[model samples]
Target chain A: MTTPTSGNPRAGGGPDATGKHGRAGERGGAGRGREGDHPGQPGGAPRSLATRQAELVEALTRAKPVPEGFDAVKVAAARVALLRKRAGEVARQWPMLAAGFGDRWKASFSSWAATQPTQGSLRDGWDFARDLDGRGELPAIAGAELAEREARWSYDGSAAPRTRRGPAVRSAAGTFAVQVAGHVRIVRLSYAGTRSRKPST
Target chain B: MGAAVAVAETAYGVGIGWRPEISGFVAGLPGLRFAEVVAESVHAHGDLPDGLPALLDRGVAVVPHGVRLSLGGAEPVDPARVTHLATVAARLRAPLVSEHIAFVRAAGVEAGHLLPIPRSFEAVDAVVANVARTTAELPVPLALEPIAALFDWPDDELSEADFLTEILDRTGALLLLDVANVYANARNRGEDPLDLLNKLPLDRVAYVHVAGGAEHQGLYHDTHTDAVPQEVLDLVTELCARHRPPALILERDGDYPPAPELTAELDAIAAAAGYPAITT
Candidate 1:
């Protein structure tokens, strides 16, 4: 895996390459690498690696322009793969939400999350359900799941959700949920075609 | 990192990654010696997952493997994550803790999956510094696992071997080598996985990971949800021929099959590594 290189700093380098190695390379590369010249650094102090990392993260998660010198095709591929993985994680957290779309879960989640930087799976699923709710596209079962979560916790789309201290009731689509003393009980079970079955909380 | 301490020497043999979904299967492994749990999934202050306590009660090694450390992130590793990992390790009484040499988040954004760092000196430094921060808080030895990436950073300034070796050397951390990753990266890049096995610091490998993957649109992904390809098991054989790692664990994240199927994969890894099967 060690490809011979010309040891040029800007190109790639290797263990046996001529440019730098060992202790000096660690110090010099860490302190004076090209990333040190990034525009976000202050006072011309060695540019923090944080700035370049932020740019890369932006490109990957926010659908921002790929950073210079990166292969657009590969970046796009990575982005798609990342979205797929996120979809899986969110699906695990919101099983019914995913089941609501069934075959379309991966595609639907990927498309929706392309521009959404993850707020973790819990919030990602919640936000997605709310978006569908606003659009009148949420399925009953998933809507019920969302209604339960909303009744139990207070999520403002910013910060982690906090437990509601008081009793709360919420509904979505045709499903209804009530939270008493932090314990949620679903009352109406019209979601997922379970209307005929007696609602079991 | 704090002062380097002597690492525990133990033979873990064949093991599996513990998930609640497949806990029953993992627990039933008759000769299992060690297992790994996702660090973030466990609660530090609460009871261990169902089968995990039984495994621990039988004196099995349950290593806390952290998936979200983002040790390669350019920013300082998050202290809260480090503390939680340390807590999990202490609770499990693990001999070692493992995390990836990749970043999962940056720029105040979560990537939700392991992302590769450039094979550049800058990245090496970032990883080394962050590893130092994490090791300082950990109660046990830390092993770093290199992730399989679908794409390489265009600004990479080193080869895979050099990048990984440099990080291991600087941090003095053990390697949690993934034979599946070696196969995935090599197959994706058209290189020989054996070449990497030859160049790596094999003695430093504390354990190994053998997972499954599938090809999608011409790229082989280390999905861990597919069956372990024969190609990867062959590489395990190749790696063992050079320097057998202390343990080899089967990693199956999702799309779990029946218990017999999972046992067969574990047995296959044991056979490939020339270790005794735990499934008996």
Candidate 2:
């Protein structure tokens, strides 16, 4: 349940990262007109809905404390639900990585992604797989999958991945992959004793 | 009472959300006149996904359902996302497009899924403004759906019906009502699903979503991966008894059942809504 002190660098780089035009003020003004209609923060100037929404989003996605006046237990449930939903999405993008963990995929992905706001499923799976490889915990079958993706796309862990225009070759664990003209071929080098071990069907 | 907008009047009977995994099963459905595709999945240019062109070729009316417009976000909706939706609508020749009333991201951080907004006037204004910006660029009508939220904001100032009505009243947008969402929210909050249905403007329903969910830790999660429970189907029957929407769409996001199970689900929706069975 540890929160990453620094959030994912690629946290919000998708279509959702559109420039923030100064429309918050305009919307705030509209809300200000009806400030007296509701009664919760009755003392000073009312907090704008935009600001409130941003706080809620931060709490939900960043493992920050649940915002004041909200149900802590329900927000906790929502946070868990979001992580589970995200795991399912990443599993779709990286099927082999998910299959590599067998029945533990949901639990593993959920825990790893608990503090990470999604950069989209593709990058999320990539990041998760790379993290597993760093710890020597990545399943060998998933290593082949990771190797193929590395050969096909060039990702710097801080930006959106781009397809490789020229030929590329990459290796991960005991797997090797080569990509030329957008076609990727993976080769898994199995050890003598590990050759017979197969993932549960 | 709002601006004059196109209403969904076509009698598109039992429908399903088209996914790549079940493309063959969906294409094989003999009577499916309506289908919805995630707007983000289709490219604005270039080639459509496999089987999408064939679905379009078969004259199935596809509606682009957007998951990232973040209409309920307090910030202005992204123009590029709107344009992408519009372009996809034009490419698919879709009758209309739909997005959630919930926000997916805020303050440049993606929630990765729909998040509920407060049921307050300010939140309503945000949705209305975003919907205006979106519909201005849309080539067809836009339907806004209320999401099934796990929690309600503490500052909610309006009832669910009132909040949804106000947004719809201002935007003049059609409603993409999800019956499963209605059941989930009501079951979670211990309210009657039929009560909300009684208060909502049923005539504005552009279409209906019927999905499955399972209860987790005393809360009903509207996970489309599960089978459509009998309670959800019963609600569908109740919805049709009051006023049948033009279409009732079966949405299965993951854990896609075998073809026969999927066909049976579609048939069940057809049975509930009194629409002709599309599984033949």
Candidate 3:
């Protein structure tokens, strides 16, 4: 954990902690409050769901029927864990991209939650898909292609923050992108891009 | 009351509760008396640092506190989590373990945030059953906490204080009274925290937890990113004056300026209680 005392890589044309883009404290107009507590919806007749959620949902209605065998509980559990895991992955490898998420990310998440089917079964089904992804239950991507994209996520930031014992190891198990100021840091956890890999039988 | 807490009542002294950003500092600092290390803080991370126990050996009582026990959750307290807490507390030689009076889990679903229980019999039964199970085999008394809540149910059958009083009476658990939470609830919900505390069986107070929160949209979020607000300070000062509990810990999660800022906060605690400053 050799925490560098000075000169962060992301400091390059970067978002200083207090900078407008990545600045955490300044959420006045940005609406950084909880999703449920976000500012009131636009004043007018309510629009259909798509306009509010078009970008975030990815309309998985087309997600090729996943393997049929997983139990409902197993699937939902997998999705919740995966979403948390995916967020964790992002926090690890590409924090910069996460920073790019304006209030929209919160809204996107809210919209996804809002559309949760009225019936418990469908809601459970939705959770199953998410959890599977979180648990890395999905098929593996090609190593080479994953490496290329993963490489693009590299965060050449300033030396890590100094701890009493110097910088602790930044986990490389996944990728997370958080935006600091104007620049985004893509922190990657190292795995040779074997993330989401299934264990060999 | 769940099971007779094996350890005798003791005050470990004043110390700030645990936060991840300060773990290393806490691990190294020996002068601090007690560390209320949140259970999830350890599990969310990993193996407890060996130094943590060593810190205990050096005189710091490291108690494992938790928010997820969801004693009031829709489902029974998870047996696995209870086991984890027991292990953590035993290793730390903690005299007591604590969770909030609220439920953070629901119907087997953990929302990752503490959700308020409707304060009904169903909720009470859920909590009592879980609390009993959590402390079934523990060597320390499992403590219950009062949290600062924003949401409320008009049809809520029980008041927060009444609910807590009943839970303590039924479960016989120790109380981890958070003055800040008491004040927060009083202010936000227009209920009197002191009035609530007055109704409580003070003999159950095993420890006191206090922290800072932010005011937003006519409500205070228990953000804990700053110094203890004056409201809490006033309340604690009064509480300590009347009844000195076993231990008291100051909590600051973010915006931790420097030692002086914390020292000053502690100074106020000392002043309010008419106790001498802790020089160490």
Per-prediction fnat: 0.49, 0.59, 0.00
Give the per-residue Cα lDDT of candidate 1 at A152.
71
What lDDT does candidate 1 reach at residue A25? Answer: 21
Most TM-score-accurate candidate: 2
The candidate 2 chain B region of ten consecutive residues with least summed lDDT is B1-10
Give interface RMSD for all predictions.
Answer: 15.7, 5.8, 19.8
Candidate 1 deviant stretches above 4 angstroms: A1-48, A183-185, A189-201, B1-8
DockQ, each predicted model: 0.24, 0.36, 0.04
Question: How accurately is candidate 2 docked according to DockQ?
Answer: 0.36
Cα deviation of B57 in candidate 2 (Å)?
A: 2.3
Local lDDT at A30 for model 3: 34
Please provide, for model 1 over A115-167, each residue's C-alpha lDDT reduced to its tens digit, 9 standing for 90 to 100: 88876676688789999988989987687678777887777776556567888
Q: Using DockQ, give the best candidate's number.
A: 2
What lDDT score is found at residue B100 in candidate 2?
98
Question: Candidate 1, residues B32-134: lDDT per residue as tens digits?
Answer: 9899999877776756667888999899999999988889988788787899899999999888899998987765567767888888888899999999999
Question: What are the per-candidate TM-scores when only chain A is compared?
Answer: 0.70, 0.75, 0.21
| TM-score rank order | 2, 1, 3
Candidate 3 stretches with Cα past 4 Å from truth are A1-94, A100-201, B1-8, B24-30, B43-47
lDDT of 2 by residue, A87-149 (tens): 887777788899999999999999888777777777788899999888898898788778877
